[model samples]
Target: MIALLSAPSNLGLRPPQRGSVPGVSKAPEALREAGLFRRLLDDGATDAGVVLAGRYIDDDDARAPGHVRNEEALVDHARRLADRLTSILDAGDAPLVIGGDCSLLLGIGVALARRGGAGLVHVDGHTDFRHPGNSDECASVAGEDLAAATGLHWPAIADIDGLAPYFAPQRAVHIGHRDDDEELEEVRGIIGLVVSAADAAVAASDDLAASVVETAGTGYWLQIDVDVLDPEVMPAVDSPDPGGLGVPELTELLRRLAPRAIGASVTVFDPDLDPDGRFARLLADVVVDALRTLGTAV
Candidate 1:
């Protein structure tokens, strides 16, 4: 059975204006409004209930270690989220975590690590491996999630509950990154397989799925940041990259990939930019379709 978990945290996205409207934090409610949970339940999933995070506070302090904005809040939220995920796993129901941003990947990583380690399949537009020292915008935790998950960043976030390198370097696969940053090269050195967007676009779905499953080992978590879709179809993200996978392509990939995952997360979709809620509905349908595929796999 699959259960939906809502982790509405936007601490990772630090808006320049203090009181700017929340983006990713509104994703869970938006998706729910689009009938995501109902559709999943109708397709045979049980309601796992929502796990709400604390309110998001934008702290402009540059003095935080690693230049992480809302560092304390981020750490606290991650810890809380880890606990929630562990409980979900203990219940034996696959979790469909709806996220605030990519930073929630840290919490999910920690949860899997505590339960005896798991592989990570990161499907997104950016590598999300930037260190605070290298980034021009020094405060967004969203940009550093992969680094923290791999034990490359601050101990507070990386070594949650005294665990470090949540998943082994060899057990992680990053797919669909388009950025040409040095961090992508750095991640390539550590991650087992780095499938560029161009490579994934050309590769057969079965081949790509086989590679990701083989690299991720027996158990793994799948993370999908909606920005992986082309801007023409998914322009509601904070940073939309051009020339991304089409919705059909991503859906097919997920159908092949998700069946091997212990759980999955959908992140970085900002309903604020999607005024008509078209993207939300599209995202909801994709998730429901993936869940249906997963049901068949199990």
Candidate 2:
């Protein structure tokens, strides 16, 4: 069965400069209020409850290494989160970890590493491979998740529990990234296949899913950052890049991808941006439908 795991974290987002709202931390509750868990339960899924971790504590250190915000809290949270995922997997349930932000990828990576490594299917609008040094004032850990997961960044974040490069470059496939020139250049230096948003637009969904599965080998972890969807449909993310996949396109891709995944995560849906709660409901439906496609639900 698939278990819904809430990871309510906002540590990865940069602190509000002033008078800015903080709401990603509340995604888990927001999604539940929108009946994500109930819908899954109606479809025959299990509720794993939430994984408690350190609360979001914004960092004030501008000179921190790699300019990574909330370094200490992030590290601690990753450790605890990894432990929780490990427990769920050990119990033989597929975990559907929700929200916090992309930085929670570190914990997922660590858990997979403990199980002798796994492939990663990264679906996002941005590549999320930016090295900390390359980022500006924001220096959000959410933006650097994929990079850190692949060991392209600091050891503390990348090498958690001495498992650096959680998934080898050859074992990962990054899809749907629409990044700028410099970011694309950096991504190119990485040792994995990057399928741009444009490429995904033209490629057949089955072919793309097959290619990703083949690349990831036997088992893989799927990460669906909602920003990967078009801003028109998913405007609840922290950074909504333009020109992303439509809801139907993303749903088709998930149907093709989720079966091969051992576990998966959904991130970056900010309830504050979705004041009317419409986007939250839409996202919940998409995810539930994907889980059903995975055969984890009735």
Candidate 3:
């Protein structure tokens, strides 16, 4: 069984409504509005499809400045969210979380850690492991999520619910990163694998079943930040990365991978950065396809 949860807000960065990134869909909200759970429940009853345990994180509103600025609060909220997600995964169910931001990785990592060590396949344009310190770059806390997960930087992040530094450095892989920065060193410092954009596009589509099987063989938790897709294909994401994976490649990858995991959770962040619904639809298809593919593995 797999449960779909939506955590659709950045506790730190609150964009306006209908402000999805260019290529990704804002379907999470629409799914809620359209009574998606009822439809899924009905579908499951008829088809014995994967179960949908729909949930949304109801924490301090994203717009609350205190919540936004409080690192302790953000980390705590992530821990609580992880606790809920952990219950689902612990029951031999996968969790597909539609995220509020990349920050949701905090919860996902924590949940996976409790269940047992899970490898991470992080598909994004940034290495996400920024060295922690006082600097202009350190102001935006969300930027360093991957870094925090690898057990570097902020004490608050390192201590989330006492699950500090949630993932193993060697087990973490960064895929589809086109833009490079100082953070690359941080990733290397943590000894995370760097899978380049060209390699991702090639691997995500070609022989994806093999790729998934091989990757999953290592026991991984896959997390895709929509920004990893080219801005042309998914333009609505915050800080869209140029020249990255295409939709078909990404879809194929997920379709191939979903079946082989011990458990999996996914989060699509920064949908409000998208202007149209095209990106949302693409992301939704990826979810639908991944969920459907699980049947083949059964």
* Residues 94-166, model 2: lDDT tens digits: 8889887888998899999988999998888888877755765436768888888888787878898799988
- Write model 1 residue lDDT over 1-298, tens digit each, in one string: 7878898888787683765745898999999999998888887787666666666766664455555866777788888888888998898778889877888988898888888899888898888887754666656768778888888777877887888999788899998888564588788889988998878888999999888878986468888988889899889998888978888888889989877788899998898888999889999989887656552343
Top-TM-score structure, candidate number: 1
Regions of model 2 farther than 4 Å from truth: 19-21, 61-63, 132-138, 179-181, 295-298
User: How good is model 2 by TM-score?
Assistant: 0.93
* lDDT to native, each model: 0.82, 0.81, 0.58
Model 2 scores a C-alpha lDDT of 0.81
Model 2 vs truth, CA RMSD:
2.3
lDDT of 3 by residue, 259-287 (tens): 65544544444444545555555666555
Q: At residue 210, what lDDT does model 3 achieve?
A: 57
Ordered list by lDDT, greatest first: 1, 2, 3
Better of 1 and 2 by lDDT: 1
Q: All candidates' TM-scores?
A: 0.94, 0.93, 0.76
Worst 10 residues of 2 by lDDT: 289-298
